[model samples]
Target: MSAFTESALLKKLSELNTSQQSIQTLSLWLIHHRKHHTIIVQTWQRELQNVAEPKKLTFMYLANDVIQNSKKKGPEYGKEFSNVLPKVFAHIGESCKSDKLLGSLGRILNIWQERGVYDAKTIADYRGRLHKESSSSAAGAAGAHPVAATGNGNGNGTTKTPSDKHSKVTDKSEKREKRKHEERLSKSKRSRTSHHATAATPIVEPAAPAAEPENGHTPPYLPLGEPPEPEELIKALNSIENSASSDALVRERIAKLPPEISEISCISKLEDKEKAKLLANQVNEAVDLLNDYNARLAAEMEQRTKLAAMLRDFQAEQKELLAQAEQRLDEHKKKLAKMLGLQKEIHDHLSNLPDLTQLPDVTGGLAPLPSAGDLFNTLH
Candidate 1:
C-alpha cells in the first residue's frame, strides 16, 4: 500500500483507543513512522518526476533508502515498536531536509516546531534552504548568466554583463528631462496665443469735445441776501407757477437763498403773527411724526430678532429629531435582523420534526375529568 493510505489507517487505529496514555504512546509511534515517511516519499516523488537523467536517478536512490529503512523496521509492530521509532523518525526527517525538498517542508516544519512537535534546529535548517532557493530563482529570472546559445548581448555579437542599477537610473533621468521639456513647450504656446488675441481686439478712443456754449451766455449765479417780505414773495411764487420750466428754475434759485428766506417763503402768504403761530404748530407735528416712526422701527426690529432666534431654535430641534429618527431606524434594523435569524432557527427545528399531519389522535385515551370533591381529597 502507498505511504499515504498506510498513514491514514494508522491514524484511525490510534483514534480507536480511549486511554490517554495508550493513545499518546500509539500516536507517537504512528507519527514517527507513517506520518514522517509519507512526507518524505511525497517530496521525493514530486522532485524526481520532473527531472531528466542523473537527477532522477539520484532521487530514486534517496527514495529507496527511505523505503528500505522502513521495511527493515517491520510494519505493524505493537507497543514494542515505540522504543526505536524516534531514532528512525529523526533519520528520515534529516534526509528530507536537503535543499531540493526544503521549499515543500520548510513552512510545514515551522508550523510543527511552533506547536512543539519538531526541534528548532530542524526547522532552521529547512528554512535556510528555502531562502537560498528563493534567492537563486530571483537571480536566474534577472538573466544574471546569459548562455552562449541564446545570443542575448550587445549588438556587436559580444555577451554583456547585467547592469540593472545603471539602466534604472538612466530611465529615471530621461523621464524627468522629457517632462521639463513638455512644460516649457506648453508655457510658450500659451504666451503666443494670448499675444495674438490682444493684437486682434479693437481699441476705442475718447469722444470729441462737446460743442462750445453760444454767445458767452454764463448761467446767472444767485447772490445770498435776506428774503423778500411775505406778501412780495407770495406774488413772485404765484407768477412763476404758470411755466413748468421757469417754476423749477425759480425753486432752485430760491434754495440757494439764506435758511431764513427759505422758511419765510414756506409761509409767505400768511400774516406775520399768524405765520409765527403756524410755524410753532408745524414744529410740534414734525416732532410727533418722528417719535412715532422711531417707535414703529424699534418694535419691528425686535420682532425680527425674536423670529430669527426662534428659527435657530427650531433648526436645532429639527437636528435632534433627525438624530433620534436615525437611532430608531438602526434599532429597528437590528431587531429585524435578529427576528429573521430566530425565524430561520425555528424553521430548521420544525423541519426536523416528524410529520404530525399523518399521526392519529390519542386524546380519547386520557383519564376522565374528576369532580371538585376528588380534587380536594387529592390536594389534602
Candidate 2:
C-alpha cells in the first residue's frame, strides 16, 4: 500500500508504447542510490510482514515477475511491466526499515542481478556511487568528531593530532585491502576457468560481470560447460513426471553431466560453494521424485490387494448361497418321493375295494327290486 508500490508506473509500463526514458532513469537511480535501496528494502520487508496471505504473495509475485522478465528480456524489460518496478520500490521504501528486511531485499536483488536481469551500466554506476559514498562517509565521520576535528577545547591548537592522521591513513589502508581482495578473486577465477576449459566440450559465451555478493565480494563462476540450465533441468524433470514414465535416456543424460552443471542452466555469478549447494538440492529433488514413485506403486498394490480380498469374499458368499440352495432342493426331492408313495398306496386300496361291489350286487339287486313293486300292485 505504500507509495513505492508504483501502481501507476506499473500500469503505464504494461502498455505497448509507453516511454522507456522514465523507466531507464528511475531504474538506474534506484539501483545506483544505496540509501534509496536501503529505504526501499526495509519498507518492503515491513509491508510483507503485515500483509495478508494472497496480498503478500501478490507483492512477492510482482517483484519476482519484474526481475524474471528483466532477466529473460533484458534490463530494459522492466518497461513492459506497467508500474511494477516503481510499485515494488515505492512500497518497500515506504514501509520497510529494518536491517533484517534490508538483508532480505539484498538477497532478492542479488539473485535477480545474477540472473542477468539488471542493466550493466546501472549496476556499475550504483557500485561506483556506493564506493564514493562509503569513502566520504568514513572520512566525514572520522573528521567530524569534536575531539578529532578540533584540537583542545581552548581552540589555539594548529597541528593535527596523531589520531586524526591515523584515521586518514586507516581509510587508505582499507581501500588498498579491498583492492587486494578483488585481485585475489580475479586470479582465483582465472585459474578455475583454465582448469574447466580443458574438459569443456561446448564453446561457451563469456559471462557478464556479476554484482558484488552479499558478503561484499564478487565470486566468479567457472566457465559454462555442456549442461542444461536450471530451468531446463526442472522442466525435464517435470516432463518425466507428467509422462509417468521414467525415461532411461533422460536419466542417462543427467547422470553424465557433473553435479554442478546438471543441476543448473546458468552459473554466471555463483561461487563453487553455491554451485555445490544447488547440486545437492537437485539430488534431493531426484530423491523426492523416486520416493513419490514408490509411494504411488505401493498405493496401486494396496488397491489391488483390496480388490482381491473383495473378490474372495464375494466368491465365499456365492458358495454359501449355492450350498443353501442345494440343501433346499434335496428337501423338496424327499417330499416329492413321499407324496408319490402315498398316491400309489391310495390307488392300490381303491382297486382292492372295488371287487366287493360286483360280487354283493348280484343277490341284493334281484330281491329288493321285485318286492316293493309286487306289494304296490296287490294293494292297488
- What would the per-residue lDDT of candidate 1 be over residues 300-355, giving only the tens digit for each residue? 44334333334443444345446557867898899999999999999999999999
Q: Looking at candidate 1, what is the lDDT of residue 242? A: 53
lDDT of 2 by residue, 1-380 (tens): 11344443344233212122232223322333323344444444455556643244334433443334234334433443323444444444344433323323343344445555566655444334323433454566547654533644336544444544544554454455445445655775665456343532222232322223457543322111112334644554454354423556645644565555444555555769976688678777767766665565444443343333344434443454465578668888899999999999999988878566556556545664568879899899
**Model 1, C-alpha of 34: deviation from truth (Å):** 72
Model 2 Cα displacement at 333 (Å)? 72
lDDT values, one for every candidate: 0.42, 0.44
Error of 2 at 230 (Å): 18
RMSD in order of candidates: 38.5, 31.9
The best candidate in terms of lDDT: 2
Residue range with the least summed lDDT across 10 consecutive positions in model 2: 219-228
